[model samples]
Target: MASALSEATSFVPDEATVDRFYEISGGNPLLLRALLEDCAAAQDRETDVLDPCVGGLPGSALTHAVTTCLNRSGQLAVTVAEGLAVLGEAPDSALLARLCGLARFSAMQGLRVLRAAGVVTDLGFRHPVVRTVVLENMVPERRRELHRVAARLCYLEGAESSQIAPHLAAAARVDDPWGVGVLRDAAEEALVEDRDLLAIDYLELAHAFCVDPRQRADIRIRSAVVRQRNDPFAAQRAADELLGMLRAGQLTPAQSLATADVFSGCRRIDGVNEALAALRGPGDGAPDGPAGRAAAVIEYCPPWPGFAPGTRNPALEWEGRSAQRGEEGGTAAEELLRRTVLTDSTLATVGNAVRCLVYTGRPAAARHWVDVFVREAERRGADGWYAMFAGIRAELALMTGDLPAAERYAREGLERLPKQKLGTLAGGLVATQVLALTRMGEYEAGARLFEQPVPEDLFTSEHGLTYLCARGCYNLVTNRLSSALNDFLAIGRRVRDWGIDQPQWIPWRGEAAEALLRLGETTEAEQLLSEQLSLLPAGHERVRGVTLRLFSQTVEVRRRPALLVRAVALLQSAGDRLQLAQALGELAESYCWLGEDGRAWAALSRARGLAEECGAEHLREALLLHQGPIRSEGARADGSYEDQLARAVAQEVVSNQWDGGWRATLSNSEKRVAALAAGGHTNRDISSQLHITVSTVEQHLTRIYRKLRIRGRDQLPVDLQFCDGPTTSTPCRTLP
Candidate 1:
């Protein structure tokens, strides 16, 4: 590398710079030599050194190098290289000879010459970019002809259709029965491997060349189904293109039914409804065969649920309707649902089923179906399906009060689906994560949720009700009372306007009542709590316990103990350790208000135990705040500020034995902490590594900062050294 750099540039590079060039240039000799040549020709070379950052090189440099090398290999080798680039498969000499119209021995000779030129190997091009460069340098007409010939050669060689597909797809919509078959098989292979774009491209290519109307419609339907598993925005574009074809009478009756199912899968309610209606025609509301089964599928998928006046939690309402429809949805819809479940369930079909099980008060059944769905999704390796269903699993965990598990699953789902591709699934999954964090008293982590950017349409979706409610709870706990109240109030407005009032989605009234009560709006608090109680269905002791706990606060003091007693019984039975801990704390507060000292301590003690078990530091902290205002360490009527400062200084001066100024003044623990902070360990990392709480780490840092005269961790002296510390059990001497 150094020799190459010395030969190409006026300046010579050192050993370290040569090693860096080799490493970043990615082990490709052609690419590396090209980089050195490009760096030599750069206009900035007057000021720059011989060492080149590969990213700074001209992209055309590699292409030009490969082109010059091919020319030096002579005409036969150049033709062989072009054919190989067009094929992009294994370097089969026979196939190369056939595609390039050369004799087999001549092709072998050319390949040998090319390999010796370092443009290729006995296997293929040294790098994928080299292959791409060969194609890039070729004219469009020549490239197209090579693709056509390559497709024919591969087919005649008895290759699999999938192996022959790229050439046909690249041949610019050639009309061949065999090529269409190859593209179709290629599309299926791509879909299996989750190469959605390639699959869609292959299907579209086949569709363009297909002459039969039925086959063309079949391709369009397949494209729509695959699109449902992709970006919702891209799916919209595909749907729009299909809609034009539908209106043009390009689709048969059965084709329309299939298209309607695809639309339903996309959560496109209006599009599904319209397409099915067109299939039914004027008086055929209940047509048999394809049309009836299609309409039944639509009916089975709960559309935007309509709420009767005074209906508060319509998701439960829809859940009941969903059950009734499954039983009486006639033979067609029942067969589709059963068929989908038993054989091959699509996301839309299984998602609706899981939705029913999750929100309809069946935790065990919900867990079972979620596990089954997740296993199926994983087995198929469909990231989008796994993400969506895994999010549902997280929601189920949240509902069951498994706070840690809920956050874990939600995080996994988010990791699988990038935020840009999340679509409507974002709100519910994000809401689940925030709510679990809030419930576990992870307020700082919960607060970080709001800092992330979301889709502009996120707040307008149906799941926005749940997302806003989760944010409102975080706001409520963090003392943003007015913002919390506004969040809940907006949910209420959405309930009336959009008619989606699912308590499982968001108990907005209950959340608003807490915010209002905190803000001292008593009347509205009482009314909202009352409405929340009425809205909840029977048998959800968990949701009921939550509402009753809040309601206990709204009543008179004498009546409070009785309401709280009922809440404790209900929450204890419900087995939500987090909520039960919170209820116990609230009951303890009520006891204190009533001057029942013995009972107050008992309840507070139990609450604290539960809070610690659940890792709910905020709840434990709340107990502390209830006693009185927390004071600073030196705060008292004992002395003035200066007098206390002098006393503290005198104690520090007498305590220290070393002569290193402020460094000597630190306690052994404080010294260990300062050294770790100087080593760039974050507060959480320091706390974990040192076997201490984050709060204690913070306190140590505060005292260390005051003693060392440092403004922040970054300002600490880099020379400050300490062991991972003899007392610490951590094996590492420094933070990883």
Candidate 2:
């Protein structure tokens, strides 16, 4: 059939080709192709049409070429053109129609022709740039003229916003009041449809045409949020702009509160502090109806209505009280910080503030606020707000070490959010699940959550931060030091970008810094930590604790006891038992070196107890693996890896000299197996210990043979090398 079509067309080349197709049949593919088929028949050759500009018709012969050779050739020429047109140009149906017209063809017919030519596809306008152009191309007058018609058609056809944006925007541009109103309504419907990158697109468009300042602020805030996940720098820039608006008093107190939300997403401490400054700025001092009420929801009304926390800043508390009563506090403190909390806008800032506080480690305060906000949201039957607050509650639970509760709340939040509207919230919900699973020792499941394609416009300093945490944790547990360092560096970049000054991230920063220290980048690590400590207040316990740990480790390795003592003191005050244990173990080792057995035993005992209490198996294992500090009942001994090797040579034991055998005695694996043997680690633990198959461990032991070795893992001594020790070159046997 294709050959018959090919035999009915003619070829044309050069300058006349561009004009030929159009001149033949008004550039109509069906009509021009008909003419070309006639031309091909006259030449008595298979219809073969060649025209540089196909317009509506390339020719009957070319059709056969496409249908037979070109289509099967895997050539990208036609596919590329279609991608450029459909993905590159047509965002909306109206724009599609206009593009068809510009190409001098009917919209439907043009699509059919492209489809026949295998040049265009129907991706349904998920591509943003395509949609942008399509909507923008419809002249304002025409768009307004057609918006209502297009909307009705779309509604009847069950079409989506992706199918309706260009029409609505066109209607909005044409000043068709009904079209504009319907477009606004459609925008809201579209916005609520998903929690994805696409959701941002629709919301942003709606915000652009929205005259309602409050709604626009809401959309802008959402846009900032989506942007923060994809490009933190851009997110910061947008957040700063919103802060600027708030600071300039251009936005209402309510708007300022919403704008502050955009800043909350800012990972940088600088951005957070900047937003905090704006949120607490001078304009916040005065009363302004519902807006004032909204502002007070976050600031003044501590945990509940008309009640404030005792820990609240006295001046701020006093100001909050005065504002709630509609009476000025009559002081500069009051004037600098004041806003009322009323029923109208109570849900917006109140819940978000609680979330922020929890994340920053003000758990007690966050709990105080969350209790009030959750109750209020439920009482009002605001399901959306309920879901939002519920999610925040779940996050707060995670922060407080209530893993089960966090999982339950996260599940409940996911279920509550409308199924159809799961876009970015879905991503957020999934991320939460990853955190839970990772903490529960399910690394693979957790890694799956990060598999989503990162959109170009989606900004996330937080995602990067969280990713660094997860990746680093995995590497740390698995002993993949190099991979762990990469994750740490990634986290450092995010931290540097986010400018997070709070102590919440200090532990991760410390871990990364420690990893750098291990990688022999001590100078760089010290400088980094020094810079970190400079920003933190001395009163901050976590920062001080981490600083001390790093200090103790770095200095003590150089045998500096004074620095170690200072580090131990700092860690002790922070209740960091695990770190304290490790630090004390190091001190005990030093004591052994100095032949102070009694002091070493006391420190070692204290370290063991602390490690057990903190569930620090790794640290405990470290202490037990080194024989030097062992003060068993009345026995005290000091030995090093070097001393062990020396003893092995003296014994002439064949098992002693093998590198693997040496490792079996003092290696971390052997230490683990020993600890687990004392605790009854099955064959599984033994396998886990050597990071090898249980069969392999058994084989090594069997090779020791009956006369030379002990039986079973239980009979293995702490210092027994499985293979033979090294033999020296003897002077007595040195005859020529």
Candidate 3:
């Protein structure tokens, strides 16, 4: 049977044999023996080697290739082999020394034996495989010692820390001194991948093995950051452990600072504030040497839940006076700037500290730091962080009310986002666009974009409720009343569910109430508006003032003079231009409704001025549209004209069935003219009705067409389409 198998193999290797060769090479001793027997049998013949790729190379061939590379580099010597003796993977020179220093020479010698026997060989003549095999056999402590050594050597060789970290980590696991450093490098790489889970593992390893409390603190802080999103409370717990070390004098100030930052990042506002307080506690000995400067401002990283400038935080203040350090002129900004200056030129630290600068309302300082981050990101070919910083700058512009600049910056930032991050950040970009468009009075376009669905994940952020609320307001502005109401109701439920009755001056909530009022739901609208108004913080006087202005608009139609006067008076006190314009527009309509034409015109002119001041072209347009009701020549001066006008407005309202106020203005004669007009009738055709001459009919028709602003009678179709009710096409009957 052996003879038959040998003859069957012949001198040529077949495709079928490739798997057996790889398997034997992979660690099958029986398969290796069989393959060797076949190779010996075919040695004398001109063999057709079946090796087509790495997959096809035989065990013998791989052994020869690895040995040849090592031989050619003259790295098959005892010195090189001894260095790789204890590793299961590539070991830098330092790892070899550490193993030797630890009296683990026997483990290292095993690798040398494999090298000599050609059982293990160098990858790129570096003896990588030999080292890996030897190290695999060592105890965890010895392996960790070797890994610590290798990490240092790799760092000296300018190798990528992330690329070399795994091997070093094994060495560190065996009580290696350099484990902490290796873990730091690995955790950083994992963070870049957003693989916080892996990062936390490495950090814990560093914490357990690192002798230096400061180093342990550094790793623990990063681990806490990794855990923050998945389990915020746990992350805070981990950070608190580090803080305890600092308080016990077991950690340095720099380490304590890092731990405090992790707390802030997790939004553990109370914990961060408490840590800061302890850091600045009485006789908390100052940090020694260069770290002392950081000690003076250890409490200045700005506690979480930062306010936009000029905003009050009564609840936060009441919670604790000392913890309320995010108030105006807080040292957080200054200390952050100082640390930012101390940051190394590395992309990592520069990017890290600058992020705080932006968050602390020091964007200009951040701008300088961003320049450094941009250069490094470009060198690394990573656009993600660069684009994020650009977006931050755009937000700063928005806060300053530099709308044109904000738009430009936001657009440019969108262009810089990498494709991988597009889904995550796209919603914010779309929101920025919507804000710009709304500010520019492009309501229709904004409404269309707002209707686009947002990702469910985005709803978990701080801005989630605000984004949903904005969608409601956008719908309201574009006349999508039912949709607006639905969005408003949804927002109400979510906010109530979250127990968040007091959102900041988002304005969307107020706008939602206004929409309800516009839809003629006065009672419900008043209640909602009152709820929002009640929550308006003391510092947000502008918003509260605006809410009062909105209150004056209620019942303006029924009690025009009284409501109009209140609206105007509210505008006179601490007027926001946008609010003033809205009030004046309402006041003008009230005057017109009460037949006080002179007062109405004057009020309209005042509204136009404020609209111009506020750059609100849409409000200006609304005021112009309302002018039709007052100046319409078709509206007769006769007593019977009143009933006719009311009936016509009612029919127009019913026809549209969407706009109640519009229906109220449509007169009977107007509806008559509209039905005939929609029936494709001429002015003369409509003229014959109601016993009027064609000349008078023509004159009245001209007035009718102008009042509705139709180009001609044909375009002014009756909304109901027929005298009886709505018809699919023109009615077969003439106007009565």
- C-alpha TM-score for every candidate: 0.59, 0.40, 0.44
Q: Model 2: how far is 427 from its true place, Å?
A: 5.9
> Model 3 off-target regions past 4 Å?
1-149, 152-182, 185-418, 421-429, 439-453, 496-500, 503-509, 555-736
lDDT of 3: 0.50
User: Could you say which candidate leads in TM-score?
Assistant: 1
> What's the lDDT for all of these models?
0.66, 0.47, 0.50
Per-candidate RMSD, Å: 22.3, 22.9, 19.7
Model 2 Cα lDDT, one tens digit per residue, 1-736: 2232344433224455545444333343544464454455644555345532332233344344334422332323323223223324444545545423333244555455444433334523222322233334445554455554554455546666555655555444423333334444555554344333454555556666777666666666656655532233444556666766666666765565556445443322233334434434343433345434433433532212111121222223433343333223223223222242413233334443454354333556556566665675566443445555666776666554445566566666666555543333444555565555554455676566567543322234343454456567666666677787777666555444444323333345566667777778776565555444443432334345456557445543434343344445545544446566766677667666667565566667777777665544555677776545455545334334324323432342344311123444444444344434423356676677557788865554454333235445544421122112211111211111
Model 2: lDDT equals 0.47
> Where is model 1 poorest over a 10-residue stretch in terms of lDDT?
727-736
lDDT of 1 at 188: 91
**Candidate 3: deviation at residue 401, Å?**
6.0
Q: Pick the winner on lDDT between candidates 1 and 3.
A: 1
Between candidates 2 and 3, the one scoring higher on TM-score is: 3
What is the alpha-carbon lDDT for the whole of candidate 1? Answer: 0.66
| Lowest lDDT 10-residue stretch of candidate 2 | 727-736
Residue pairs whose backbone atoms clash in candidate 1: none
The residue-level lDDT of candidate 1 at 279 comes to 66
Please give the TM-score that candidate 3 achieves against the real structure: 0.44
